[model samples]
Target chain A: MQKVFEKPQALSDTPFAYCPGCLHSVVHRMIAEVIDELGVLDRTIGICPVGCSVFMYEYMECDMIEAAHGRAPAVATGVKRMLPDSVVFTYQGDGDLASIGTAEIVHAAARGEKISVIFINNGTYGMTGGQMAPTTLIGQKSSTCPGGRDAAAAGYPIRVCEMLATLDGPSYITRVAPVDPVGLTKTKMAIKKAFRNQVDGKGFSLVEVLSNCPTQWKMTPVESLSWIDENVVPYFQPGVFADR
Target chain B: MTTKKILMKGNEAVVRGAIAAGCRGFFGYPITPQNEVPEYMSVLMPQAGGVFLQAESEVAAINMVYGAASTGARVMTSSSSPGISLKQEGISYIAACELPAVIVNVQRGGPGLGNIAPGQADYFQAVKGGGHGDYKLLTLAPWSVSECFYLTALAFDLADRYRNPAMVLSDAIVGQMIEPVELPDKIEVNIPPKPWATTGRKGRGKNVINSLWISPDQMEEVNRRLQAKYTLAMEREVRYQELAVEDADLVLVAYGSVARICRTAVDLARSERLSVGLFRPIGLFPFPTLPIQWLAECGKRFLVVEMSHGQMVEDVRLAVNGRAEVIFYGRSGGVVPTPTEILDRIRKTYGRSAGVSHYRLNPGPEARR
Candidate 1:
């Protein structure tokens, strides 16, 4: 009998170290699958951030570099400039990309650096225990904002896709979620497009995945998926915000 | 065949030296006293088929250096004192990852945006690991424009030899001064093979350039390996210059631009029939400690002069270790000492032993009883 499914060749035998029910495992697989499908595993370089996905270098079969917290964009710029023929990408979280590393990401996009970015918007700081992030929604409860996020105190959530779309450097910018079968397919397609843009030398491309953090959200896996559809999808508005 | 000597500023020499040493990537931010480096690199780097990027901030510039270095590329970044302070985080990460790169710090007055004048106040920061954790940058202090070009080239070889960061710790006076320098011929660039770099794995296994050793036992092992590399450097890489030190009654210790001023002071003292000598340390990190200790053992008193309040004096004191007297004279906030001021200090120091007499010579009461 022919095998129906198997692990992507771009992934290693080492198991992922992500927390239970975290969508990072799903996104990691999607990125690995894209790398395999494009047959660019030999020339792909991945930059891992300092959040929950910091250990991604251990799971991915390609060459990897672990960037300092929030500096993945800058690191990717360095790598891509040195090896223009290689495919470079960064895997960053909400706290890593939207908060501490805001300057790095913005300038990288503005420079139109030829790189692909996989941004995970889980609405909380999953690595350091659920703390407030720049993407944390208003009236959403986190450890820092125990009562709820207040507009006066914490401000509103930042829509990264919309914010980056204003820049003229990016070739493609989209938002997607991997909540269900249909959602997973769309998210995978968006991720593949971002990588393809870089391979085609079109310049910077980013796909923001509105991921789930069941451990930090204080809900079961099934409940978190429903909460994303009712709450996150409406505010974030998943769609292609920029494609040039 | 010999290359013609050309007149250029010390900052321009840094760029030329880096290019000659096969450095193809330079990321820097504009700051005073060292802005000429990035300005010259912008025009010359691309001409040399290299990458020159003006990063948004000093922090980003150093991280870009980290990324390029991870790819086994000859990369560098230059900044002044304040900008270098912002780069400490990335420098620490680069050090932890054991990546080979060169960083130029044309130090100015500090403590907080003090001024844009020459200062040696960063001696402690450069030699004692400016960033967090226990690490050493193979620091080279150049006193003249010619030395700036030569040492900058040497820094790359030393960095690649040990797979550690090397620093060209210059001062504003040296960075801005213009002098004639004989650049190297355009020979073949011999970059060592980097088997561990994060270039595409190709036919080999995956390569990971990282510093995160979460396990305590593994982290300790990495630290031990780093220490071993530093110890080897200290043994073989200490560079210094000693003029008339063997027969002199007093030795003056200095580095960078201050050492140039001290050299003139030594000459004036010698003309006045005073037995004063100059001992200039070119390698500041592996610090020429044994020579200073040997001089002290031979009954030579030391006068440590600097542009800071007194930073390198601590290392001098440690080397002397109660065997001889160590006097410190310094100026801060960009106030550079003139040759006349140094000669006056040398006269006063030679007249009597009014400096730190070494605790062993006059011990304090035990337990203040």
Candidate 2:
């Protein structure tokens, strides 16, 4: 029997840690697939931030460093600067990137660091009990914002791709979702392009993945996928914001 | 570049030592007292084929060190008092992950952004595990320019030896002061390969350097191993210098820049036919507790001198266990006592001229209480 699909060579055989319906698994697999395709699996270093994907180091076969919350960009910068020939990337969540670690991410981008960033925008803090995040949609209910995200109190959602597009430092900036087959294919392309940018010695490149948090969203797997398309997509509007 | 004997400031010596010790990366922010360190490294590191980055802030600087250190590189970061406080969390994470790196704290006065002048107020912070964790960092206190060069080199060695962060705790006086130093020959240090470092996956399995262990048993095991390492360090790494302490009835206990001043005070007191001795600690974390314990058993009174309001004295008091009286005299808020002022305080406490009475010194009655 011919096998139609097999695990990417850049992924370990260990079981994934994300929730059943969470899109973290999809994105993680996509990143590993990209590394394998680039034939740079052995020389790729990944900086995993504190979030639901905190254990990303365990799932990937590449060298990994677990960074403190929001500090993954700075860590990635350090590693890339020290080992210029090696490919380095950071995997961060919206809470980790846009909230607590805004300074590090902004400065890392401004420095035009030669690295890639895999940002996951799940619109909520999935690991920390579904708390309202910086990218949390207005009128969305979370553990902290039980009354739903009121713009008067919580402000508007942050569009990381668009915001980073304004900076001349980054060479490529895009947003993609993994809710469906078509979206997943687009996300894989974006991830591959971002990795290619780093391999080509281009400046910073980032691919923001608008993932879903089925467990945190208190919805079924099917409902969560629809939620991303219905509400999250309209606000986040996945697309290539910039390609320098 | 550190070829032969030359005159340089303590801050300059730190950079020279780091270069000689095989540091390939230096990340730091601009802060007072230690500003010269980064200023010097910025020019020198590039010349030596190393990386020198002035980070956005002290916090970011330490995080940068964390990134570089994860690759098992010989990296370092320098800062002052308030800046060091900003680095505590990052330092704790690095230690918890068992990464090898060196951090230099050229301390200035502080509770908050105190002053640029030299101060030893961070004695507790340096030795007492300033970060929140069950871990220990090897700390070195250099009192002179020569020691500054030697200890910084040793700090890099010790950090690799223990697979932990090592701190070179200095002060403004030593950091800014210029003195002659016989720079040692190019010392070749052997860095054992850390297979656990997150360098690339080439010829090895996946390496994950992390501190978080969600499981209780796993976290407990990690903490237990760290505590054991600290105990082993205390047994083998406790360092101090004892001067005429065997027969003296009074001993002046000090470390870092203040120890240099204490030496002058001891010399002048000895000239006055007073039985004054000096006990200086070189490694502050694996503190010289045993030496003080032995001296206290011999019925020797102690005068704990520092630039802070008696922080190290608490450690001394614990070691003494009431075997002898442990009195303290310090000057904080960026003020350093001269040799004469220190001598007066010594005289007030153990003055043979006044028949060893319970008299007080200047800063006088308020400090006495």
Candidate 3:
């Protein structure tokens, strides 16, 4: 019998504690699938950040190091240098990667560190209560910004893919979302490509995933996907910003 | 190759010692007094086929060290007062994760962005664990240029032995001073494999190195394990040098460069027929407390001389445990106490009428005649 699909061997048997409608689980599955496809699960090491997916190590069947908030890239940089032949990657959120860790991410990218970066941009701080993150939209409401994110006060959202694309260090930079089934397929392809680039000795590959936070967004799981397709896809303009 | 003596500065010797100790990674930022450390590493690391990175900031540098050490690599970082303060966060994180690494703090006067000159003010920061949390660094204080070379290597050993951060606490005086060091042509450092290191699981099970203990009971257990290791260190790692303490009635307790100055004062006091000796502590954290307590029980009075405003004096007093009188004399804000001034203070401790300090006891260049 041809088994069309099964759980990825790279994913551990531990169940995820993520909230309902959270796309982090999907992203995690995609990463696990990518690792299995590459048959490099044993040779891969992961750096987890201080975010909703901080416990990503609990689900990944590989060597993992939990980095201090916003420090996954720097930690990954260290691991990659120490074990150059091993595949190194970082799992980070918008708050961890775009806000507090801006310097680490920017410099790691600029240094052309040979590591893969999986950046989850959900527009709001998830681990801590929903706060206005650097990617929060102008009219988006968060716990910290009661009156919705004011462009005049909070400034505009950061387009990390476009911003990081300017740096010549990174060989591959793309923006993807899994708001729907078709989008999920695209996001998986982007994540797999990023991993393959590292295996091929390509320096600094990042895939910014526009994830959904249904609970924080005060929307149904179904509505969240619809919101992402209408609002996020327009603002973020998902596609590869750089590749070579 | 045979070991031979070579003239070198304390800062340069520290790099040489690290190289000889089989260090493979160095991430550091530039700060005064310790700039030579990074500058030397920049040239030495590449030559030695190691990694040397001048990180963007001290915080970044320490984090990089944390990263490298997580992979079971022998890595280090060196900085001064202000820079070390910035590294406190990463230091705390590393301690929590139980990663082994060496951190060198070349002492400089500070409260803010203080001057680059030497100071003994960092004694409390080094020994008492400058960073936040229930952690302690196996702090080693070096008094001479040669010790600056040797102790840096010892620091790496202590770090890996207990899987905790080891600090080599030096001052600007020792870091800048030039002296002869015995160098070995090649060193074969034998260490056990880091079973916890995340160097790709391969055939082995996945390794997850972390310090985020969310549960109360689990956190307590983690802390208990750390305390047990610290207890083991205290029992075996306390190192100090006692000079002429068998018959001496007065003992001067000091560390780092201050101990060297106190040694000179001890000689001057002895020349003046005063009974003064020196107790130089090498391990500042596991602090030779029992020896000082023994001296206190022997009815020996202590005078703690420091370049800070009575920082280590409290520790000496606590160790003395009210057995004898413990007095403190210090000069803060980068001011170094002369041997004559220290001798004067010693004479005053014995209830003798001593001449004024700062007045040259010898009519030499500092006579101001």
Per-prediction DockQ, in order?
Answer: 0.84, 0.83, 0.83
Q: For residues B267-310, what per-residue lDDT tens digits would candidate 2 score against the true structure?
A: 98777656789999899889888889999998899999999898
- Show pairs that collide, candidate 2: B118-B172
Which residue ranges in model 1 land beyond 4 Å of their true spot? B1-3, B187-189, B353-369
How do the candidates rank by DockQ, highest first?
1, 2, 3
Q: What is the TM-score of model 1 when looking only at chain B?
A: 0.94
Model 2 gets an lDDT of: 0.89
Looking at model 2, residue B13 earns an lDDT score of 93
Can you write out model 2's per-residue Cα lDDT over A116-210, one digit (the tens) per residue? Answer: 99999998999889999999999999999999999999899988888888898999899987888998899999999999998999989999998
lDDT of 1 by residue, B1-369 (tens): 257978889999888889989999999999999999999999999998989999999989999999999999999999999999999889889989999999999999987998999988888888999998889899999999988888898888888998999999998999999988777666356789999988888989989999999999999998999999999999999999999888787999999999999999999988766678999999998899999999999999999999999999999999999999999999989999999889888777654553544422432223111
TM-score of chain A of 1: 0.98
Candidate 1: tens digits of C-alpha lDDT, residues A110-214: 999999999999899988989998988888999999999999988889999999999999999999978899999999999999999988989899999999999
Worst ten in a row by lDDT for model 2 chain A: A17-26
Candidate 3, residue A233: how far the Cα is off, in Å: 2.4
- Using TM-score as the yardstick, the better of models 1 and 2 is 1
Highest lDDT, which number? 1
Isolated chain A: TM-score per model? Answer: 0.98, 0.98, 0.98
- Please state the Cα-based DockQ of model 3 relative to the true two-chain complex: 0.83
Per-residue CA lDDT of model 3 for A54-119, tens digit only, reads 899999998999998988888888788878898998999999999999988999999999999999
